[model samples]
Target: MPFVVPRSPELPAATWGSYGMTTLAVVPLIWRRRAPVAVLAAIVLIGGVYKVALDGPGQPLPYAGLIAFYTVALQCAPRVRVAVGLATVAAVALSVGWKTGTARELLFTLFVSAAAYALGRLQYTRQAYTEAVEARAAELERANRIEAEQAAARERARIAREMHDILSHAVSIMIVQAEAGPVAVRRAPERAEAAFEAIAETGRDAMAQLRAMLGVLRTAEASPRSPQPGVAELRELLERVRASGPRVSYERTGSVRELPAALEATVHRVVQEALTNVVKHAGASAVDVRLEYGAESLTVTVTDDGRGPGGSSSGGHGLIGIRERAAAHGGTAQTGPGPDGRGYAVRVVLVTSPQEVGT
Candidate 1:
């Protein structure tokens, strides 16, 4: 058997019908956010004409037209907005005759539409401005984070270079003294005793420089010592390491100038760390250290003659520590066999003026 479809119940007439239709027109306003132009156009075409057709003394459809007009004015571009405003005024003028329409009614409708439009416009402008501000803030934060990462990398490299320079020189001196200590004692006990004394003094100096350089790695609060070290201290570091065993040499290529406190610390740390690694890892050997201070940046290199300790193949705590120090200052560290194919070499480069550190 075929089933019959039910029809929608008929709407009642009177002020109620007009009121219901007016309410139906207002429904489109909810879609104003998604499709403002379309909703406004539909309300104007349907609601506007309905009010004119109803032409009764008290029709509610006019209120729907006012709502549509307000939406158009607020959401549409200036040109379209002006056109919508004119159209709304014309609709009202036509529906309510010039002679019969009271001045009070006309003013009230205009005032309501204008008020609604102003409110909608204020809301839209505030939301748009807020989003733009949030986006810009996020972008700045991202840039700052990237810069911080780069600085940290550089600082680690500097520390590694310093360690290599200090250790390589110290170990070379110690080895030479150790070998000569026995020979000199057999031949001349006095000379041997002097050599041993020199060795002890050099060890003390290396320890001091190592502490100072390492202190920079710790947080400011953690490190109570003042922040500053430069090429001047490099000489003392070289002397101590030289006494350890290896015959070491140092040369400054460019005009050495005072550097920023942080940078000075960075340079000292790099040389210190590099030398430490050389003494610990490289066997008995000779080492050479070079420092070049250019207008833009500084470069340090440490080379030793001990048999290749093999590339630092796996990253250990020391390597990680070195890397962290370099990154903090926007520098880099690289370790490998020396160019002469005998021992390990470490090189570090850093900018003189680094970005400010984060709190």
Candidate 2:
């Protein structure tokens, strides 16, 4: 552009040396982001040489130098930026004072440089803020996903426990009755009828409970919800077990009151599993079921005058399910020999109130 236009009579003419120096100042800008302070220094040095030695045709704005200074403000550390900024200001003041010797030109150059630096600083702040927000959002998403997976695992475990209790108890009773049916028929016809009837009743009850569980699992919204067995159903559970042959008794102590549905269900399952263990493994003649309700807790204990702890395996899973049920409500289950070390016993203690649990 300087070559195309004529220069002022007072100023030096455009020359090849001046054009080369101007090109050299602009070329270093390509590496400004990687070495911002170095790029700025190189541009300032080239401009100084052009002004002093080559006396280049002047530009309206030092475009390459301003761009390099802006990059330095954005990319360089605070200490480096401050040092380089002060040096550039001093150099600009000297250069302006020597060339035009006017305060207006010096101030104008300083104002533009300051504005460019301010814009760069604002850009860096905005970029940092955006990165922080994105990181926070990602962390929250990961936490939610982990929580959802844990909830799913808990539900699966609950379903497994329920299935084990229902099937094991029902099958044990039916086996006892079916085995005794032939003997009863040989002696008393009426006793034989009752034994057969007990088998049918047990099968139907098991089927109903299983259906309710499966219905909820398949599609809860479209399935009828059934109330799970609780403390009130223990009498019936005992009756069925008694008909199987072993003498069964139920006793409740302490202040008897309604419990949370979940706790009641847990109690019922614990007693059922313990009795199933006696009927299937322990060859006991008498079984005792006891419930002692407290101010903030309930304890269910099933003791049988059967074989000791080593007698009943409870299929290994039943006892584990019992323990898990107790632990769910912040409680515990223990299994060992009964009173006088005569038979096996399963004793479980559970918290009644939700607020008092795990306290």
Candidate 3:
């Protein structure tokens, strides 16, 4: 570009030294982002030397020096930014020689230097804003992912609890019925038939409850809805227990008020688990199932005049499940000898508020 066009026709031709200085000034710019201050100093030194040795500033401006000024504005400290920009403007002014040029040309060269610095400042600000926005978005995405995982974990725990409740009660009844069915068949065929019928009924009930609970995992378009039985299903639960275990007498005390669906279901499960324990471990002749509705709470007590609990040694989770269910509904459960010191008793008291029931 030795014969390249000039800014004005009257300007002198570019010398070999000028070309070398321009190359030295610009070549280090490749590393400007990594070493901005150093790159700027190198360009300034080259431009100064070229100005001193040459006749005057060439027709074209010192583009390399201007770029270095802008880079300094973007990457250096505030004091360094001012010094570097001024140095660039002064270099331009000195090379062109103010005594030789008109005020218009001098002003135009300074303006160009100042504009580059301003543009660099704009680039730095824009890049900084974009990076901040991206970081915020990433943080929000991380929080949402954590919340989603927590919800999924809670749902899995609920499903496991429901399944445990169902299997413990249903399997206990079936086991007792199976053990009694053969003995009764030899003594009274009709009694054996009734036992088998009870076993089948219990299986059907368990299947329905399981389908209802597990349906949440499937799409609505595929699985049919199965409504879970709550308070009203107590009678059915008692009926299922009759053939396999001692007679269960159910009594309701206090003013009966409608409970939340979750409360009702929890109570039903507590009773079911308690009764199953009696049949599996107590060997008691009879059990009392009492439901008391209070102003602010619903209480249920299941007591059996049996030998004692023998299922804990057999890996039974009946009592643990009962306590877990009670706590899930903001309730407390206690297990010990009945008040009369005659048999085992499971007493559960649950709060009546909607929030307590977690509806």
Top candidate, metric TM-score: 2
What is the per-residue lDDT of model 3 for residues 1-359, given as tens digits with 9 covering 90 to 100?
54554545576666766666556667988988888878878877766666566644442246776787788888888998877666666766775674466778788878887798889999999999999999999999999999999988877876776788798888989999999999999999999999999999889988988876766677657454455568899998888887786888999999997786777888888888888778777777888999998887889999888764343223266677778888877889988776577678889999896665555
TM-score result, candidate 2: 0.87
Q: 2 or 3: which has the higher TM-score? A: 2
Which 10 consecutive positions of candidate 3 have the poorest summed lDDT? 307-316
lDDT of 1 by residue, 161-229 (tens): 567655555665566677789989999898789779877876776687788877677656644555456
Runs of candidate 3 exceeding 4 Å displacement: 1-11, 55-62, 77-117, 212-216, 220-225, 309-315, 340-342, 355-359
* Quality of model 1 by C-alpha lDDT: 0.67
Q: Each model's TM-score?
A: 0.58, 0.87, 0.82
Q: Cα deviation of 53 in candidate 1 (Å)?
A: 5.8
Sorted by lDDT (best first), the order is: 2, 3, 1
Q: Candidate 1: misplaced stretches above 4 Å?
A: 1-16, 49-67, 102-104, 179-200, 212-359
Q: Where is the poorest 10-residue window by lDDT in model 2? A: 52-61
After TM-score superposition, what is the CA distance of residue 258 in candidate 1 from its true location, in Å? 8.2
Clashing pairs in 2: none
Error in Å for residue 53 of model 3:
1.7
lDDT of each: 0.67, 0.89, 0.79
* Per-residue lDDT of 336 in model 2: 90
